[model samples]
Target chain A: MSTKTDKIDRLAELTAQQESSSGASLWREALKRLRASKMALVGAWIIAVFLLLAIIGPWVAPYAPGQQWRGEVFVNRAEFVGARAENWFGLDHLGRDIFSRMLVGARQTLLLGVVSTLIGLSVGALIGSFSGACATLGGRVGQRIDSVVMRCIDIMLALPSLLLAVSVAAVLGQSMTTVMIAIGVVQIPVFARLLRGAMLVQGGSDYVLAAHSLGIRKRRIVLTQIMPNSLSPVIVQATLSLATAIIEAAALSFLGLGNPDSAKNPEWGVMLTQAQNYADSAPMMAVYPALAIIITALGFTLLGEAMREALDPKLRG
Target chain B: MSLLELDDVKVHFPVKKGLIFDRTVGHVYAVDGVSLSVEEGQTYGLVGESGCGKTTLGRSVLRLVDITDGSVNFDGTDLAKLPAEEMRTFRRRLQMVFQDPLGSLNPRQNIESILSEGMAAHGIGGTREERREKIRDILAKVGLPANALARYPHEFSGGQRQRIGIARALVLEPDVIICDEPVSALDVSIQAQVINLLEELQESLGLTYLVIAHDLAVVRHISDVIGVMYLGSLVEEAPSDALYAEPRHPYTKALMSAVPVPDPEVEDRRERILLTGDLPSPANPPAGCRFHTRCPWAQDTLCATERPALKDVGGGHKVACHFAAEIAAGTVERTAASVVPATREEMADRVVETPAE
Candidate 1:
């Protein structure tokens, strides 16, 4: 018994020592654990490179994004690759530089993903959290709203996502902002359901109960304690959702719901559409844009999976 | 002035039945019109079986659970009448130590953040550093090393986590604390240490406690007054010694007899009043006296037809029973005694004559 007590004392002393020591910061510890997975690191690097390209692409491009290079049309694709120097990555069907168009397209794709996902997350989080916190009539109303919203998302999901995007974009009329709003509207239900599920889980957690016992305001509890804890999963979901949003935007652009497909303006999806007619002679044009879509989506999906694993405690061990 | 008073507080949860489309149901009376009070600097212990509404009563007192009816007045302020903002202020003065130490404290938060959160929320401490210092002081008072402020809750043992729970409650400098079975989760020796720690803190901080537990022995050691609850109602309330020495209510007697004495010889010798049936469903409790179904000396008509109100017989010992006087006088004997065969009785008598201790 004395030895057992002595062991306990020793354990307590060690804990006291570790608690006092500033050995590892929380972020550093999380990062160290995260880095142990090579796939996750690679995914992170891909995301970082894409983000950098999106931010600085305009400045780094040799020629104006919309300005067409005066060169031989699709016939002199090989010559244009080295001939103009500005027409790097060869020329598109309209003799426009594919590399510059891709850089510009990256800006549009990222903007659509980031803006739409933010809009979706904010609106869904608000509705979901408020519904979770409400009692009596408000609670019932929140539940009804959640069901109706989720049902609408189900209806949207039932139709091919691209088809829905095409129809919504056609009705709203073609513009980048219109495309973003269309994507955001479709994405809201996904976020609402995610936030509501997370809120339900958090509502039963002890910290939430502790907050209640302290008589903290329901609003404060929802905003501070519950919301912060729920964010980790939401963030991973958001990353994957952004990838979907980008793909949907590309689909909308391909279906003539995006920027006008004139000689000066060539989006990656529009480039693919234009290249389809000349597929036998110039297959590189279609292949390049398709590759961009697949690679970008892959980057996001890998990052999302990594983040989900890192944030979920059950999965961590 | 009484620091806290619960006057016939009833918290009933509606029990719904049937499929998703249609349902008809009744109410599960979790805390059915139970009344009790705690004086300033006094520790009131509430003992009962698991579903006996002890926890419900504690939560009702803190206004954590919505009381279906009745008034909970703390320092003359009607808890139900207090506006949301005022109730927030009231909460700073009234804290709670939850049963599960691990569940009570946030796993993500360190000890310092947990201890300082209540103070910061109530705007009690002057500055950040002052709050941190206060946290350090409270940690030390709980017998935890001061440096433990930086540790996460998972790093500590069950006993230490409970101490952290205590520290969190005390750091608020609350006038009253509702400890919901704080040490029941700990080991036997650890339970003693925690009880001692609680007593020491109560004396030093002048803390009033409504300590809820199932263990009668722990309640006897720490409480000034003891309230025995059955089903949803408080069947008995008296001073600790008065209740233990001369239990008035039949339910209280049965409960007291059920507590396992440490001395095995005395434990064996003592008449173990075994309650035959499991506790009745609260949704449909036994008619009249809730304990009447299991009462050894239950008189048919009075036990079934009429509910007994908690009335003080004398010396502030209150019991809610039709035959409190008879039960208090020790006139009632186990009904099973006469039913057992002669051989079994002889063996039982021998065991009773020579208890484990």
Candidate 2:
């Protein structure tokens, strides 16, 4: 039998050796595997481009978005290149620059997507984690609360998300913050359910049990052990949820629920609304904003898929 | 005082109907009236077939599975009565190593993070360096290479992961560890490696263990005292040598006989005791003695009608049988022995009759 002193000394020596080695071992190998995923690299580039567009898009446009460029003839051709000077991508019924409007529209769409998702994730994560932690303490109370909350989520999920957002926007009045909150509210259920399910799975795992055995606090275990483990699935869900939020925001805005009376506002959905009347004369007006929405949504979806694959070992190659 | 004591602990879960409108009809009694104790620096082995509540008993001691009734006193504190905040403080002294090494450790965390997580949660160290130092020391003690700190769980072999799981438990300098079928999930050769590691760690650290497993060979190697569980109750318990040499409980005798001897020569000559049938469902266990349906020496009228208390026959050995002395004295041979084709067959019949009840 080895003495505790000897075990302690041996442990000290081993730890000292690990500290001296630096990042010369397995850290380098993990970096190599991350670099090898081609799709991830491509996804990274796409995200970078969208981020760049969102940052500098407004400054580079020739004309202010939503400002009418009078006397500019509308271009009718669907196959036009990036060569037009007056009303670039041709004139909408309002004679606004479609290219300029699309650029500014990118900023609003991206902001709405990111802000709403963050709000959803934070609110939903808190509710879900609290529900899980409460399940451990007030067993029956937690279950009843969980059922009520989940059923409410189920009701929201049953309705077409666009319809839910429109009604919420209609109730709260037409504004960007209202649209963001409406979209965020619609997304809460998805995050709440995802986090709750992940928590249930983590709550049963031995590591969590081990944490409990060590006399770790219920809050600490839920936050540190349960949250970290559950976050991966939540993250994956949040990524996909962002795309849906962006779509919902656009739908609400298109239905005239956006910032009304801001004639200078070039929100993507508002831009689509203005362009719909002149679809034949300037098809690019609708096409450019529609394409922007699809591509940005696509970016989040791909990133979400990659993250889900990376985090889930069962799904990993 | 005993370091840990459980008096008639039970863990039951309501079996909800799968259908939307199905009512909660009954409870799955995962553990029923299990009572046992472990002294400081001693290894107590809990042996039983799967679903016999061996794992459930271990989990309840940790309060991982909530106790439906009774009390668990750890170092003189009633664990079930402790507040949530106080319970967290109590958890650092007791740890658990699970059955599946892969399933137990978080897949997202690397070795260092996983090892250091317990220390961080319990606030064991004052600074980051102190925690890092503690993790480093534990990795080596478990025979893991120090450089393995940066690697994820997937990068390691099954044996290495089990070692990591052990390191996570030991890093906290815990007083008691409940190993729930720790080695049963590993390969045969790897099981020896893990068993040796656990024994070596125990000797060095004076760690007390509540080792739950079905593998008797592994149990015999590290256990000072062994408790045999059937359904959800401890049917027999005694020191390792005493229990193996002259098992008083018929269930234990059948279990000991079932352990395959390595040598073919001895294997051919030695008499084996086989039990019949699978474990009964814990949701609706049989009336009277839980093991009555499968007890080889079961007196149908007496065994089926009376639930025997765990009585001390002598020498700190306890057996819960109406006829324990008769069985222990060799006055009663298992009736199944004559009817069964082979000793192994009789042992199989005995184990199956209880069916996890």
Candidate 3:
């Protein structure tokens, strides 16, 4: 027979190892894994810098964004004022300071991105949770309710998202609020479908049945157990949607369905639109705003992808 | 009266068609007409093959699934007829232990919260300290370390996770615990420990159990009374010793024949009853006696046309079969026609049709 000390030592080591990890939850463990990923750290840093710029861009801008003091010097047909010391980033076709417009535009872009995402996330989560709860716990009548809600969602999903966004913006009339609503409305079906699917899976698990048998109130089960467990995918979708929302908002502005008062508070998309007239003379004006938009969208996309990996059940062990 | 009496329980799920506007095409009678009772502090084991509705029956006890037509009389009141709100309160005395240990406990919750949740819902303890004391007491009874209360379900081994599930049930001081395939998910070595823990808990706490499992040996060991399910109904039920000593039903005999005797001599001497054909779909179950299609001693007319009642054949042994007496007496021989391949028409009819509801 083998000696027992070595086995005992191994067992003790295992025990100590287990003892060291007290109350480490799925979320906490995911957070730890997220911290370890360099991708997540880089993405987080980009978002942090972007948020800082959004908050402080207006105050730091050298000139008033709406002022077109160098109008006479910036004749689009004959002469172009390239980036110079006096007017860094040069004057636009309308002779507004290009650098100052971009800086102030940062705050408006951030507002559109966050507000649209929030609109989509909240409305979608509410609709999804309602539909899921009905389907899972509502018995026969609940099934009917789910079918109705899902059919409506299906109709929304059937339309091409960009076309749908365009229609919503066209109907709402041109403004920042219009673009936000349009993007938010387009994201509704996606968020709703994801949350419902996740909740359906969670609702069928043994814990849900266990909770039911425990005589926990059905409302409490739906709210506390089912809702919390089903939120991860929705959350991942929200982050990814943020990037999409920003891009879509810019597209709306470029299409002239965004803020009407472009000269006063110039958005990047509006700048790109205004720059189209001076394509031969001032190509740099379009290039600057395009780069800004692409980089910001990239930041959110990276963060979203990193979060998806961290939260993945396959990677948990 | 028995502590829990399930009288003529049935659960039928409707088959629906159409995307938005649904139509009830037919019904899948999942748990069709099953009735059994359990005594206080007695372990009533239910053994069945897969897809035999044993799990559904267990769920029906707590009304987790809708009871089509039945009277689930628990401690004098019919739970089937109780208001949903009242039933929620009444669930304090009844609990369920699930097959999957990890799946049963919330992955995000600590053992303390998992155990205390039921107690909090039932209003068992007045204060947090009182609940924690009770929870700790139960954790010990289930053979878990005190430190385990702070850990999540994923941290524990299969057996330990099972204990946490049991602890969650026990915290509410439930009188009856329906263990649905409790030990099946565990490892062989771990299965015995969990089984022993269940027995120990029963003896110490005077807890009654309605255990649903497929393992014959596990059932015979712990169950005072054992019921065997085929399709959605009980085919045989008797005292554990009596059922093992002499299995009366043809289906029971076939099930028992599968269990190999440890001694080589005895094992070789025993006759093996190998059943032919797969289990018919519950949606279109055989017309009458559910087991008639594959029963070794199946006759043409009576076995196919008429459903058999669970009749007592002396010594508290109940069986649902027309030829139980003749077969037990060694008079009726095995029919070769029972094993015959299905005819072309029969094969065509096997595809279940959606009947108008």
Candidate 4:
């Protein structure tokens, strides 16, 4: 027992010294844990490479994403001297370079996923805070409000998320913004429930009760005290949701509910739609875009899983 | 004038049952009709067994828990009558130190933020530099180093965490602090250190404290005045030394007997009056004397039918008992039925048998 306490004391002293000198915060501690996970580091590297490729792909591609090539029999190779070398990943039935299309497709896929997930996260967090704050009141009025908000979320959650997104997309018409809105609206309930549950537990903590006794305003307590502490789980959930958002966006595009400029556009789902006819003959056309979607989703999933494990005390050690 | 006064304060929690809509089935009388006053610069120790509602009474004084009925007057202001906005400002004069040292401080926040939270809320200490200096000063007074400010609550031991808890309250410069079992969760040796620190701070700052604890010895050592509570009512109130020397109430005598005497010879020779049966549920306490069901000197007729009001005996010592003098003088004989052990389950069954609320 003495040795155990002694070790604890030593550990505490070391941390205290480190904290005083560097002013270490919770974020810093989380970063330290993130750095320790090799999978998280690899995911971060993949995301960086993907983002760089998406931004500069148009400038660097040998052929324009929309430029198509005719075969040697149809057109002389000498007339289009660089066509054979440039269309390395070959051409679709539309004759667009599959390699260039996949490169440009990354831009649309990532942009839609991030924007929609952020929209979902913000709306869900707002609703969650409202319901969570009401529940903390712990009176008749609070209980009534809490039950109403939670039941509404339950109704949304009852429908399959993809089906809801599909119907929403169908109504809005074929546009990238519409696709984002559809996927974003479908994910609101997941974030709402996670945040609300986290806040409920945090609201009941002794420190929150102590804050009440100190005469801190309810708003300040909910914002400064409860929100920050309750945010880790919601953050982890958001990362995981981003991966799902990307896949959902791709699915919508594949169903012809995506970008209206299907012929000229290089969105992954549009490429897959265009590549279906030649899927058996030149399987690489389908393989390239499908690989791009799979790898991007895998990156986010790995990072999200690592973050969840990092935040979990039982899993950390 | 007394620093704090509770005039028959009561806090009852509604017991709810139902699936679709919750219906109030009954009430748990956590604190029922408790009245006491604490003078300025004095330590008033509240003692009771677990679930006796002493903690609720302390919280009521600070208006942390709303009073269902009655008034809590602090420094000439009726807290119950004050509006929410006014009460919030008035809260600056009062503060609390919770029982669990670790749980009471925000784990995510560093020591500086935790200690400065009250000051930030009340808008005390004008500038950042001023607030930082004030926090440093308070940390020193609480025996923590200035560097401790950057550390989180989890880094500290139970004793250090308590000192930080005290520092948080003291930084606000409040007139009264309600310490709810502040040392109960600490190690035996650390309990004395924390208790002594509280006493020294009280003397230096002239801070009035409502110390709630179940340990009689700790209370006897620190409190100037002591109030003993049972099933949500004050059964005895007196100066600590006088109450310890000559306990008047039958319940007080029984409580005092339970405290083991240090010397083995004296401890063996002392008469231990063991009270039979469990404490009656506050929701449905026995009519008349709440203690009659377990009191050795209880009379058959009046003790069971009429509740005894807290009346003064002598020297400002008040006790709520029909035969306080006879019981204290050892002239009253124990009723045979009162000596039989009644488990808490049996007592709960009796409460269920009682038809009325």
Candidate 5:
């Protein structure tokens, strides 16, 4: 066997290397792939535009979104001041500016999607972390705890989402909190299961075995080593959950359970609810909110899917 | 007494079936009744093929995998019966260097965290600064730059990562380090560098090692005592020079013949003992001698019915075979045959009895 020490000297020769981002190789490589993907860029663009509109929409609107001015000399009952330069997207049957209402509605929609997703992600991720740790290194009692926790989650998953919302609403009176928490019911199980599964996989990985061999305590191992590695898939799920929340918003709007302040707050879902009443003559009104929700959902979905691909070890070089 | 003595070690993993109410249908005899010892300041190499119990045997020493039935006596203490909390404390004195360099180090943790976390857990140093100082010293010993502490595992080459893996083991200052296939995953030239590094560290640190590997050349190069394993048990054990000069077990003889000789003439003329059929699965191992299922010199009557216990031949050399003396003395004539023997059908019938896992 050759005993040349210079070979190892050359191996560690890159000690003068430039410092990169703090994220691990997995995240850095995934971020690089995301930056290169056309789909991610397009999705990011759509999301950015929606965010910008949500932020500056009220300032740019020509009229107050909730107010209806009857003296603005409207046209026929069916077609009220159709697409004029003065009122823009024209006056609605209630004499309010539809375009301004849509603009201000962007913030409400974004908030609805974001708040619900955040609630689900935080709660589900906590449950997932606990259950995953219990199952992986907890031995007999830990497995039992994981089994009970997962069974509860499974039962929650099996229940109809509407009933989950209604039950939640019953406990905490029906308001903005109820709507957001209820809408987020769809994501709890998905996040918990995803994080738990990720942790289970990393638990079996050689690194975790190495950690175990190091004599590090089991609790510390779970928190520091296992938890960090198990977050990629959960982050991707969080993004996808935003898209799900948007779809849930549509369904809630159809059921007239959307935005309790349908008149004052004027969310996209609220606008859609009002549009259905005038659907026979004003199809474009219904089309606007539907298209808005679809495009937003598509943006989040595209980004989430691309992220899933980027994080997949099988796809990496 | 030897620094590490394992007597009748067994690790049987239960094969469970059915969801919900999981039922243990059977057991996989991973490391069945393995007994060996490693003295302080000496390297004991355990060599075996893919499915052999070398890795499992190494793991059970540190209680990474629980020992089913045995006593692992280490420096006067019985490690096998140590409580989990006590095992954690015991690990400070007994560390392990893993196989995969990249897979062993946490991808998310930097070199500093990776090295220091163990020291912190074991309470090696008094303070954070003391720990960092100790970690730097270890990094230097393992041939890594002081600056490497800031980098992640993926930043370094395979050989460098191995150095860090060794450093992680060294930082613990364990009396005995179990290196499980340490240099097998590295490049050939790099393997030599890593091996040299390990040797240098062992010399300087006065550390004992139970090095497990499949590469015969690598094992022979560094080991003081070498054990050849088959299925889930060791078939032969001898000093490095004695085992290489003359391998008594039929399976070891086959392995020695497979090693390519440097001399061109000898390489061309040397008779190769090419055994037929796949290695029998450990889940359902052969009835008698584990290697008898594929042994060329296997006697039909004794090899298939009675298990062979490892017995001392002479001068510390041990062979677990029914006809070890006869095989070594050449009294039993070689059966007339090609690589595939004439009694293939008989062997096949015997092999068919134990269904592979």
Candidate 6:
């Protein structure tokens, strides 16, 4: 008994030695790869700066987002003509500080992007998993269900995304909620197709077969064994979709389909529409909001691409 | 009563054709009419070449694949007739260890969850603590340390992973285990270690196993009863010692001759019967004796027109052939019907000739 205990003790020591040497899990391995890449770091920093700006941009602004200051400053046309030290981004057609509105617009654009992307992701993932699960668990019935679900997705995918969003927003009436819903609805087919493809590949893997042989419930096997392995590509696609969502939402608002009270609230898309009249006189008003959208979208795209490279098992050692 | 009985079981996968609307044109007879049994504490080894449907036969008993016909009796219950829920209940008594050890385990799950999955599924342990204790005990029994429970499958070596696979099957205290080439993927030394561990475990736990492999030496070493499968059908079934000493069926004789002997003197004098062609498409097997297409001693008349049933010549040994006694007594001579082995180009032409459609 003493020798047996001692043998186990020795084996335990060897096991601990091996564990400490190879402690990284899949997520940790992906993180290590992400940290090693220079472009991914730049992307991370850009996203962080934008997120911080969105959260506190209103508090740090020199003036209110919609404060009109025509007569208060230069009493005449000079307020609209040149830049002032007080207003770093100069004045718009309404003589409002472009810098303040730009800051607040960051918040509005980001809120739209995050909310719509979440809706798209959750709804798309649910639909994809349902179709994927049916195809995996139902056997003959699953093949029929798969064809039906995929055909619906194909029909949605056939329509131009912006056109679909436009029609949906037109039907729902102009509001922030409608813009979010429109963008999210447009995004559904993309996520659904991607996740369904991933799930199909994972469903045929040997581990899923092993799980089935163990007499695990089909539902449990689909959820626990197949779902987790199928998530990496879906997650990477979600980030990329955020960039698309932001652009789609902004396009809807630019077409006079955003919140009706945009002149008071001052979102980036509404701000762009308001800046169109003074494109020559005060080009800074148009440039600032456009730059914000472009930079924010680029940040998400870069990060998503970097994540795809990092999480790819083939790319790893 | 036998611990498990497979009575004339058959599993045929439909071969569908056409791009738009797939219609079944033919069936791949993967496991065609196989009947065998495993006693309570005996090990049954099934030996066959690759694609001969040995794995399909093993999986049919566990109901991993739906049987097209016949019954699988497990502990006096017909598993083929059992409802899905009732069959799930019986899964605790029958488990499988897969061919690819690493591929068989979920990469995301820790060892504790993998080992305790069957237990938790069947409500074996009362609480988390009890389950953890059970996992720890099984790990130790499989020659793993206690710390293994916290690690994932990737952290272990191939041999270690196979041990974990066995531990998972053993954790449920199963009555029968269908091990599908459990050690074929490991190093030779590792294979020996795993086989010895299986033997020790069987002695301690009194477990019955249905071990499937392509290696005759490996099967002979571990099996109490051995069955040789040729193209989705059993050719011979006998006690392991008897089967190794005197393999009666021509297919079994060809299989036994192919196993390499370690001693050079004995190896040089041994007769080797090279088969004439690859396995004919299972979707369209020959009309009569399936082995007649390639058998060296195949007669011209009855062997091609009539299918022979497995018959007991004496004792419990069974053989499926037209002239098992003549071949065993060395009275029959090899016929000149054996064709030269087909080349790859010829094989490809054959495949194109009979498309599934």
Could you say which candidate leads in lDDT? 3
lDDT of 4 by residue, B1-357 (tens): 787988999999888899878899998899988889999999999999888899988888777778899999899999988887788888888988999998888868888888787899899999888999999999899898888887888778999999999998998899999999999999999999999999999989999999999999999999999999999999999999999999998888889988988987676556777888899998888899888888878888789999888898989899999988887777888774434345445667899989865
What DockQ would candidate 4 receive versus the native complex? 0.45
- Which segments of candidate 4 are over 4 A away from where they belong? A1-21, A69-95, A137-143, A270-288, A312-317, B18-21, B266-280, B292-299, B336-357
Q: What tens-digit string does per-residue lDDT give for candidate 2 at B215-258?
A: 89889998999999888888999999999998988888788878
Give TM per candidate: 0.81, 0.84, 0.91, 0.86, 0.90, 0.89
Interface RMSD for each predicted structure: 2.5, 4.2, 1.7, 1.9, 2.7, 2.2
In candidate 6, what are the lDDT values of residues B277-314, reduced to their tens digit?
89888888898899998899998878999989999877
Q: For candidate 6, lDDT tens digit of each residue in A250-281?
A: 68877888878775577877777767766765
Chain A TM-score relative to the true structure, per candidate = 0.79, 0.83, 0.90, 0.87, 0.88, 0.89
Task: State the weakest 10-residue window (summed lDDT) of model 6 chain B.
Answer: B336-345
Show where candidate 6 strays beyond 4 Å: A1-24, A68-86, A90-95, A270-286, B17-22, B336-357
Candidate 5 regions exceeding 4 Å error are A1-41, A71-81, A158-174, A309-317, B334-357
Cα lDDT tens digits, model 3, B93-147, are 8999999998998887788888888877888898989988888888888888887
Q: Number of the top candidate by DockQ?
A: 3
* C-alpha lDDT of all candidate models, in order: 0.78, 0.79, 0.87, 0.84, 0.86, 0.86
Span of 10 residues, lowest total lDDT, candidate 4 chain B:
B336-345
Task: Report the poorest 10 consecutive residues by lDDT, candidate 2 chain B.
Answer: B337-346
TM-score leaderboard ranking: 3, 5, 6, 4, 2, 1
Q: How much is A148 displaced in model 3, in angstroms? A: 2.3
**Docking outcome class, model 4:** acceptable
Clashing pairs in 1: B264-B356, B264-B357, B265-B355, B265-B356, B265-B357
Report the Cα lDDT for residue A172, model 2: 93
DockQ of 6: 0.43
- For model 5 chain A, the run of ten residues with the poorest summed lDDT: A14-23
